[model samples]
Target chain A: MIECNNLTFSYRKATPILKEFNLTLENGGIYGLLGKNGAGKSTLLYLMCGLLTPAAGEVLVNGVNVRRRLPSTLRDIFLVPEEFDLPSITLEDYCRINAPFYPDFSMEALKRNLETFEMPEKIHLGYLSMGQKKKAYMCFALACNTPILIMDEPTNGLDITSKVQFRRFLAAQMNENRIILISTHQVHDVELLLDHIVIVDNRQLLLNRKTSEITSRLRFFNTLGAPDTDDPRLLYSARGVGGFANIARREDPLDEETDLNLESLYELCCRNPKLVENIFNPDNTSEHEQLG
Target chain B: MNNLDNFDKFSFSRFMMLAKREIISSKNIFLMELAVVAGLIIIAEFFISWSALPSLNDVKEYPSCYYSDSTCVSIIFVLGIWGFAFLANIAASLVCLKLSNKKGRITTFMTVGTQGEKYLLNFLIYDVFFVLYFFTVWLLVDLVRVIYVDMVYPFEGKWVLFYAIDQWNWMVALGTIALFLFSQAFYTLVSAFSPKLAFLKAFGLSYAVGFLLIPYSFFCSVVLIDKSFSGESNVIVIMASSVMIIYAIAMQLLAYYRYKETDII
Candidate 1:
């Protein structure tokens, strides 16, 4: 299990990035960390990876402090950053050096993953293209088989075919021993794979819910005309091709058949910051519990 | 299981891998070594040639062949060039140390087995390579001198040749050891910090030290060389060189011990 208790982090003293953040993630589930460009998504990921030091509170992975950088702790966690430079060496040579770090590392699996990603085995890492290098690193990380894997925009540079292949690979690879957290702006690509959705805005966790519960409770309905503007739960009303009334089902629904489009829900959540904060506040755990 | 700490499993090979990476990836180091070696050879040749120029008082004397001058020039040239091998070894140690620093101690601590021990071992290995290279250069120079000179100077005093070889050999050996030991300390200091900034930091500090100490210490030895050639043996100069070497080794070990307990950033 990964736990963050009252985690307050900032690059500088005054500019607070993450404030009094508390989050818990169990093993096996795929978590999608969604936020805007400067909403601290990457910073949160880096904090979890132990890449950046936390100002207050602690990030404990299976009772081990990440700050210590213990080998066992590191062996259990793998952070795939968006921008990383692999050392200039052949795939074989790179594997020979890094593979031994993780006890569960499988050379055979790494080789197979490389083939799956359509990366050549013999070429030096420096010779590989940017997309290919990312794939190679991803392949190696997957084969490392760490229990906690944090990937920052894993699908950023992937081609159409590779992206599809990557999704399939991820689905096939995921297991109960692993907890994967992916931070990305491309929600559609990861929406199907993620078991849970987490949104960050206004320096706090605005929403954190299981996909099944969220989809069931929140109905995203389209209307030809604008609904009563005074409705307290009317989170957002986007004027689409028809009219305004892009409603988020925060309270009891009028009818049962309507389904919530996650993209539309995300859009609604971002537009009105107060509604999201009010709905998912720590004080109202009972509401979230009811959804569970 | 009892023998192994958590780090032991990964630390050994990771450091070795990084060391190999450092050596192979850096071409600038080799170029620097070559440049220094070549420069030393040229400088030594110039000085030897200048010293051999005949004075006005020896105008009527039997013309001595410039063969002795050539021998002296060649010996000094070889010695100067060979000195760079030791300096190059120092360069390798510094590079490895710097690279380790930039990568961060976490990399060494988590991935490599025995971070401290592996650091020391890799540095020593780098030092050994340069030391052996210096020895090889010396042997090659000796071979060329013996083979090329015998045909020209048909019969010369073997004692003179032996004396010249003995005097130069100690200087070469001492120079090699002194630099190697100095590099060990430098590597520790650099590795204690991160390799990325470590080079600049090490260079900056060393340069500072050189500016402060070189004029007084380095020049003092140069002055002693002249005095020794007069009537005095210059025992103080020999003692100072010996003391400098011992101090270098002690300083390196002290740095290594300090690094062992300190928190790595």
Candidate 2:
């Protein structure tokens, strides 16, 4: 379990990015963290992993404060940052140096992941392209087999084929013992893999719901060429090359189930926050999913 | 947060792993720095030793700076020892800078090991390992200089490894080392506090410390210039060494605190 209790953080000479933010993420789920640019998505991820300390409250991983960075804690968590430097060394040498620290690290799993990514087992890190490096690193991060894995923009540098490979590789890596938090702008790349969605904006958690809950509560449509493209019921809509992608509350039992459109869902939450909030928490109560 | 306090407990195995990781990851950087420092020290030693020759001395109007009270004690050699300390200062600063500099690097470092292990690794690399490397390089150079000078240059008195106790300049050497350690520690703290431009900042602020070095330099000048002034004034040596060592310890503690509290940007 990961818990952020009344977390407040701000950079020097800047307004608070997250103030009194409280969130609890349970294990065994792949959480897709969504937010606008500069909405503190990366900051929140850093704080969760103890890379940045919070000004108030604390982040607890498995009941221990992450800031302590105990070996027991360190070995169980691995972060793949949006940007990282890999020393100019062979992949084998890199693993030899770093793998011993992580007790659960599995060479077999690494080899498997490498195979899945279609990367050579003995590629030199310095010689690989940016996308290949990302693949190699992602393979290594998964190989560590840490219980809590946090990746910022993991799919940013991936090509189309690599992105598909990434989703497959990540899905295979997931287990009940692991919790993966991915903060990314590439929603389509992760939609099929993520089970939970967390959206934050300007010091607020605008939305936190499981895919099942989101699909159960709302519906999505491709209505660009349809006659009712501007339907009155659309909570949000965006014109596309084909037509409009639409999101609307699922009001009737007979309403056909449609896949959750993350982009349209984000628009609905951002454009009419009050109505969305009413739909999710009609009683105007502070209670919701384990979130703040 | 129940076991957070227990996380501070030291682990010997973890510390060893951290050592292994740091050495392997930074081997290139370590070797490059060693090469640069070695070159500078070698050239400086070569020139100083060659000029101290009696054959080269005949052409001089005044005694060479290498001669102190008619003995071939090089001021440049003394300055060379001080130079190592300044190198140590930069070395220490660079190590601290790693803990705070790049966001990605800082994230890895901050999350890698326990604070105690990481702090000790930083201290051992710059303060212990690099110092040993520096001294070993200097001694080998000095050994070569001694061998070359003894074989070719005719001298009335043979030069010894400990610089001969007859000329008690060893005290000056020891005293200066302590002063340099203080400088190293101060720069380590400065870098820990400001990693963005630590080398430049340390260079900028180093001049402000000359006032503190005036008294020590005065003692060194007196002892080296006046051969009559030996270790008889051991009180000044003891006082200066104690002051500098204490300052070094204090600075190290401050640097450690800053490192412990560092948040990766």
Candidate 3:
């Protein structure tokens, strides 16, 4: 379990990036962290991983403060940043150095991930291109089998086929005991893999919900032409080349979950923050105020 | 495990793994250091000792080794260069740890292993490995020079050959050890504070930081030339050694503290 209580952080004397932020994530789910360019998503991720020191409060992973960075905690937690460097050594050498740190690390898993990513097992890390390097790194990260894995922009440089391979490889690594959090702006690439969605901006959490809970409460779909004026449940709409993408409230509990369109969902949350919060939290029934 | 009071953050097995990582990761750096050390020695031996080459004209040729005219056994100036070369190599090699001032590289290193383990591993790599590698290269290069010098000058005492271990003077060794420790600490201090353009910054900062070594130059003049040279009282030598070693250790501790405070921005 990962828990953040009253977490506050800032760079220099600028306005606090994250202030009095509180969040909790349980084991056994892939969490997609969504936010705008300067929305503090990466800062939150860094705080959780103990890479950045928080000004106040603490991030606890499995009941231990991450700030301490104990080996027991470090061994069980692996972070793959958006851009990273691999030592100038062969893949075999890389594994030899890094694998021993994580007791659960499996060579077979590495080989399987490598194959899934369509990469050769025997390789020089320094020689691979950026996309190939990300693949190789992601492959190794999954192989570590850490209880908690955090990746920032994992698919940013990947090609279409490699992105598909990455999703497959990541899904294969999912287990009940592990928690995965991926921070990215490229929502479409990881939209299918996410079990939960978290959106943050201006030090506020606009939405955080399980996919099931979100789908059960809200319906997302695209309609031809502009949205229907007669529909009372339509919450948000975006004009696209094909048609209008829309998100609507699902009043009936039995309503089938519609496929989530991440772009539209993101637009809705950004434009109608109060409404998004009100929909998720029933106690806050104050009429939704659309932010201009 | 939550209490962390008895938690063994430093595992011998884990440190060994980190050490292995350091060796493999910095092989290129070590090679570069080797090249530098070898090159300096060649310059010290051949280029500086160009008295062998008859001057083409009456005009005097400028000397590269201004300080004591560096030879294989000449002290101070050559040792300073070696220290600088070693510092440059280590700083350049640890580009993964914010040495290159890159966010991704630093985050990669900061996320792995325990803090203590990482510090210890870096300590070994920065200090111990440098000493061993430098000494090995020094010995081999000196041996080659000794052979070449012997061939050119067949007379018994024409040239001062490389001194064997048994012939080493305790006073000179003490001074050398102190200088080496100071070098290690200086590198750590400069590296911890200044990561980008570190080598140039370190050399520039060396002058302001030279109170630690200015006295040693005087000590070197008295004892460096003659291995058997001794003094009436060892107070000056002992004092300089004590000051240098204490400063070295203090700088090391400060560097470690800076390391602990590292935040991967």
Question: On a 0 to 100 scale, what is the lDDT of residue B200 in model 3?
Answer: 59
Candidate 1 positional error at A102, Å: 2.5
Error of 2 at B159 (Å): 6.1
lDDT (Cα, tens digit) per residue for candidate 3, span B1-265: 3444434456676677778877787689767866876576556556533554334352245332232223334553345344444554455334324545556435444545666677667667655676566566656655554465444433221222333343456766677678767766776677777666655566667757775446545455545644434575466667878888999889878877777777776
Q: lDDT of candidate 3?
A: 0.73
Model 1 per-residue lDDT tens digits across residues B135-204: 4554444445444444344332122234345445444345435544554456445645444455456656
lDDT of 3 at B128: 69
Model-by-model DockQ, in order: 0.21, 0.43, 0.43
Candidate fnat values, all: 0.12, 0.51, 0.53
State the lDDT at A31 in candidate 2: 97
CAPRI rating of model 1: incorrect
What interface RMSD do all candidates show, one decimal each?
4.6, 2.7, 2.6
Clash list (residue pairs), candidate 2: A63-B1, A224-A243, A224-A244
Each candidate's B-chain TM-score, in sequence, is 0.54, 0.78, 0.71
Model 3: residues with Cα > 4 Å off, grouped in runs: A284-292, B1-8, B47-97, B104-108, B148-169, B226-233
Model 2 chain B: lowest-lDDT 10 consecutive positions: B62-71
DockQ of candidate 1 (2 decimals)? 0.21
Tell me how candidate 1 scores on lDDT.
0.62
Q: Which pairs of residues collide in candidate 3?
A: none
